[model samples]
Target: MNNIATTLFLGKGYRVKKQVRKGNELRVYIEYEGKQRCPRCGSENLVKNGKDTKWRKKLHMSFGFFRVYLLFKRQRYKCKDCGKAFSQVIPILRKKERFTSFFKQAVIFWLIFFPFDLLSLLLGVSRRTLLKIAEEFISRVMIEELKDKERLVIGMDAHRFHRKDFALLLVELLSSLPFGLIQDKKKAFMDFLLSLPPRVREKIDEVVMDMTVRYRRAVEEILPHAKVVCDPFHLISYMNHQLMEEKRVIEVVKKRKIPGRVLRLGKEK
Candidate 1:
């Protein structure tokens, strides 16, 4: 329509207007501008040769059934001075892509911020794709933020999602990054820990975990300098349970106060 309309379409966003039907042909009105120069070659000698219209059925703004009016204005070019003749390109959306890049980015952002399964169901994508996107995003962030000298504490443990008993996780405490996941077995956990480079292992300061004897053995064998702190939460839970049992025993002794009970209690003490 105008330069301002084209600029607005380039800046914020654009949507389909309508599809016009004339006699035996269909013409679609899209919020797009006339063809311009190639971004890389900077050529301006171009003309509109033909147009292709595609009917895309998409959910319209949450609660409506509508079709997308996509008019691909193919351009022809003649640049005898530069000895080049090419077609003017539309660079905003890629060819064969069902959705725009901006729309894909919005979907990715939603997946990163929200829960994966929920967002996948809402956006009509697979959970595997959601997880792959999240993992790639996390890997990029970690690569940017992780420093050579930063202290990294990796906690290794087995986690079970369901009936499968063998699921191991290596979680980096400082960066909150997942190092690796393997089958919940000693050999798998040992291999993962051993696979870390010397420099990375040296950066580790402490590893806090539950009182698993196998884990303690592995830590002592592998990380000599790193402090293995028995998780305070688990320790406190165990101590509280022991104290309750002791309190029950004392209450029983006090309730029966027989001479034989006292002597037996003294002997047990």
Candidate 2:
């Protein structure tokens, strides 16, 4: 029945041509009715050019005594307007990739229960492909995590890494996890902030930092909505700075260099 085919191959776009089973291995031959748009120019003017001579086999996971495989005859299309060749855009398949999107989901789901080697052997895919898939999955998950935050409290500060080398550290204060390390906090940090997804930027509730003029200016320009709260140590340090300056002025009024020690609190210190 088409219901079984639709469930196995992902949707109405596919029609079951044939189904073969030998022992525990199951092969489902199908045809795809996919989006006929040019991937290059987004034009719908396409013409059937040719079809692949061989069937492309994708390893879909196991289902109760049966290892499932999707066999598809890929069709090629030539864009009439762009004069370029393209393939049908399947929502469940990545362009020029062999496996379906469900296959990726299945692999990620089962990897928790299976060893990497066994999973790779069962899927008949190489170890390198598994690593690549895992990396892609982790990257997508991290991005989703970043985007899903309701409120993000950010902290940014410049620190001297070594003599004559300075760097900017940007982190989520709530999570204490650093997301960005920039060579310069000035323009680089602003650029990094700008590069963040607009949704993420909108969720920034506050930014904590020392009263670095450039840092403050960057925040004002990029994330003006976020509250800027100066760190406590910097606030005390600032008071000490002003006190030291007033002491220097008092010494100048006395018309002599002060011999007593002053509180060594300055930006350099």
Candidate 3:
């Protein structure tokens, strides 16, 4: 039971001290059985400080539809060599954190299928914690090397988050991956494009975007080799606007509002 628990969830160099099951919930009490040394100075000489009264409950993956949580209190210590205070470095966990690394991984995995609130309720985690975990994971992903840099079908669009605020998102259409985010402005977008390598810019096959005149002009000037295509939603919207404008002009001439491209039977009525 002990060995299985360690290998499965507690992680190596950590031991399961005690375990309990209540209804569908499983709680495993854990302790770090690894080396006791200062992280900064690597000294074995240390003084033990007090620990938290409440056990830190970190949610791991579900087992057979049963919620699993690893409960443990971090052991605080003061290093004699460097005079620095730190906690026992828990394996499968980052330094001094209340939650395990696996907990964050579980949050990220479930987030793909379920929305934040729903996942939070399912995992017994708070929505705020899920958001924090997502932010942490995304920041880590930003620094990693990108793959398939050449074969990219890119899409750029501005997302309005507030009444007056907007953000530009650059998504790889083929892979369905979002790679870049910047302020929604011409200069910000231009700066981002200019920052990319010329070789990469030249290799980009196409850029699909909404029919923004300035955006169209910028892409043409910067990536002249790459083909630019307007997305269908914006194209339809543009045609509808043109039809409305034409109808308004006709109404002024005849003094009546016509019913509504309002595309009828595969052709404009």
Candidate 4:
């Protein structure tokens, strides 16, 4: 039981001290192993300050639909060298977070494929918390992926999420990863493009988008070096419409000539 509890709830550098099963929830009490050390001063010479007055409860990833909670009394220690007091760092939990790192990671993964509300309900976490996690994760990833690039090829598109609200999406064409989503009109779109670094904007080689005049104009103004390529779907659709109109004109001309031809033939006869 101890081994399973340790493997389930405690990560490296941590050991399970005790576990209690209450109703549907499993509460595993945990503590750090080895000598206590100060985080700031890294001194092993320490004295017990006191046991934390409040129980710190952290939510862990569910096991087979049963909720798991990690309960620990964060031990406070006073360092002799630095004369500073700090609580022992929990290896499995992030600083000042109510959920374990494993639980936060699971939430980030689910937010990619699941609806926010659905994930919140399934994980028993608030929707606002889930959104905040997703936003921070996405922002970090975007900065890391885009910060060092010298050149880029981009694709721009928009989809209507509401009657009057549209979301403009910009994707890196080579990587096929989205870089930006602007929820506004053409003015906002241009503003976003202009907000990019001048060197980065100058590095844009090509932009692929639907044949919207506003988008074309914005790209031309903001990224002077980028060659704008209209999406083939829109180009093909336009050509098909033109071809149908020409076919209709030919049919009308043929109908008009038939009566004249018949009259001439009767007069000759």
Best by lDDT: 2
Query: TM-score of every model?
Result: 0.41, 0.49, 0.57, 0.57
- Model 4 C-alpha lDDT per residue in residues 11-128, reported as the tens digit of each score: 4566777788998798887776656778888889999899887778988876445788988887888999999999876666777778887787788887678775577678877665
Clashes of each: 0, 0, 0, 0
Name the weakest run of 10 consecutive residues (lDDT summed) in model 1: 58-67
Cα lDDT tens digits for candidate 2, 38-140: 8888898899999989988876665545578888877889998989897666566676666778888887887778865677677777655765575466544
> Worst ten-residue run, lDDT, model 2?
260-269
Q: Each candidate: RMSD to true structure?
A: 10.3, 12.3, 6.9, 9.1
- Per-residue lDDT tens digits for candidate 1, residues 1-269, read 33533532434334445556555334444454444664446776544444434434321111012222245444455553454655545555655545444444555577556664567566665555544444444444553444464798866666542354445556788768775655566775676568666777778789887788887788778888899987777898787677667666776977743443444355544
Error of 3 at 213 (Å): 13
**1 against 4, candidate with superior TM-score:** 4
lDDT of 3 by residue, 1-269 (tens): 67857555665577788889989887888877777889899899999987878888866666435877788888989998899898777767665565678777877888789876577678776665765676456434641323446576789888653456666778778777776666688987787788775665766789999999998898888888889999998899998898778778877887866667343233433
Tell me how far candidate 4 lies from the true structure as C-alpha RMSD in angstroms. 9.1
Off by over 4 Å in 3: 45-47, 62-66, 94-99, 112-132, 146-269
